[model samples]
Target: MKIRASRISDSILIAVSGEEPDPAHQNISRSRRLLKLIAAFFSLFKLLLTRYRRPEFGSLRRDVWCLDEREYFESFQQKDPDDSARGQGGASQQEQRSQRGKGKGKQTARLEPIGDLGYSGSTFFTTPNGKYLIKSLPRRFEYKFFTRDLLDPYVNHMRAHPHSLLVRITDVVHAPHPTLGGLLGVAPTHHIIMENLLYGRDAEGGRFSNKWETYDLKPNDYFFPERDIADGRLAPKSVKDKLVDEFHDHVRVSAANKRELLRLLEADTQLLADHNAIDYSLFLVRYPGPRASTDDGADDAVPDNVPFVDSDASPWRTGLVDADGKWTYRVVVLDFFWARHTFRAWALTSLVKSFNKVAHKGPMSITANPADYRQRFLKMIQDIVVEV
Candidate 1:
């Protein structure tokens, strides 16, 4: 596939196509000319992008940052976690500091994968401090369009309500070379840097250890239950354990808080539905309330760090706790870039490899029409936000 992007006034124009893959064809003829133009184009893009935070949506700014192909290390940052974690009886001294002390200079810290590996067939990794998430974009996704559609509404929501539940997207990245190189059945990769819903509050030095129970939730008949889960097989055990945890079946909050949560959810989903998007799940995380004890779920042992979560991630702070000791939920709809396609579009595009299941049912299923998708999406969200 051939991919290229250029800034168009306030928005960027991204064009990706699976025209021809043969290196022989690409190296010689018009493809070579296109490469030369691209090199010149992006070089110009870097220089011009300095003032181009145009129509900036909070941190949802535009840039073309590259991942170094050379020296760099992943250091899951941990500062003075030694004595506290030891006293708390969390992970072993060795295990907690495993990824640290092995880096140098700018390699001091990097994003690390937590929870489930290869969740939903996409590589899910979070920043060392758990403030940002880096995930693989779908082959069907048009990043420029996706960014524009979601970012506009997201910025507006943040501006109006301040701490909204919408998952804030700060930046979208286009890594030219394959980050997950030679992975079978995987298409060209474009990563999205999203504000992690777990800890929107950016803490000092980015060292966080808040024990949170997380779930990617959807209503019944949503097809969210994978065959692996159905066949009594669930993955990345860390996440699966919490997925089956009884305490998290439903979030407990006051009626007033429930109403507020539902209202925010509806607004976020409406934005997606209006854009003809579906197959998104509301990611729910439960933090410890004042009266609630924080535990990392290791029986007979106290949990790790109580993260003073990142405060810079403004939108996610809307998960307000009530006067009662019941848990509050930090919820955001995720994976809305999976678009429904027209008959002609589907039939024509079917030739390429598909990451998504074409036929689906219920709320999790996608629709070809925007209006149809909107109704189904709203209905499911309304069903989810009940008991208010």
Candidate 2:
């Protein structure tokens, strides 16, 4: 991973707001503006500098920005109806304050692990203010495939279809180093910054909130070792927990809303299949609706990245309220990194075939062909989303 300095400089330039300064203040503002700019530059530089100060390693500090990501997120935020509600009150105010704090003199915030500790090997960290998630790309092939084959197309698709349910990847940071630690998977050099869809669900800054439940859904028709190995007797609790599906109830929405949701999913999955992507899951979240409020402190803040429509009848547009108004749903397709052509996928497919021959079971989710997987995935979701 070669860290490009020019790209970082360009990113800093792009991050600066494009709004013109007021004409009246321009003459008097130049000196103050220059001083402020210099201070901000140093502040950013200090933040980017790694804390590690090993003399032998020569002050390990490498920060490379994925320039295109900045523009992509800028467009995404502008297009996001939820984000547009910032400063107007409701849940957006918390996120607004979080962003405003980041723009101040210097940032002291750091990334911390979310409570769940995801089943995936990669580490998941959330920003201090819970606005964004930082996910490590420990696997070389997955990250390489994303950057080489899918990045540009994904960005273009999101730009064209801003309301698409695909997860918003805000930034990609590459911190290259000459150490063997990164090569051994001890320290991941590549990471992606994504918008936290479940932000503000939990108590934050003394603000209370209603409970929000989340589910990571995927097709479970095939034999799962966690569930099939003598009812998970042979698997560790952690493994069993990760593979088991706990979401038994259907996504109770009206028939019309279901159709719209499926339509969006069809388009999203088609893009993944077109690129040979597989093993993606629907990350669904739901909370009590207005009538079924569980907490008195519950506010009107919506997921920052999810599109909120103004029409009351439109589930997605109306912030995903259910047909009966019992729950509000937030859904996005995630983990579309594994590809059919990848060596890992091929190995998994081979292993599944060998196991299926002995146990008479179907292929695991990861082993399915892109087209086949898309069909099964859609059908599974279709079964889950039923009329209210």
Model 2 C-alpha lDDT per residue in residues 228-278, reported as the tens digit of each score: 868778878877777735588877888888888888889889999999998
Cα lDDT of model 1 by residue, 231-269, tens digit? 536545555443322233444455666676667666766
Worst 10 residues of 2 by lDDT: 56-65
Q: In lDDT terms, which candidate is top?
A: 2
Residue 16, model 1, lDDT: 13
- If scored against the real structure, what TM-score would every candidate get? 0.54, 0.68
Q: Looking at model 1, how many pairs of residues clash?
A: 6
Q: Which RMSD does model 2 reach against the true structure? A: 11.4
lDDT, candidate 2, equals 0.59
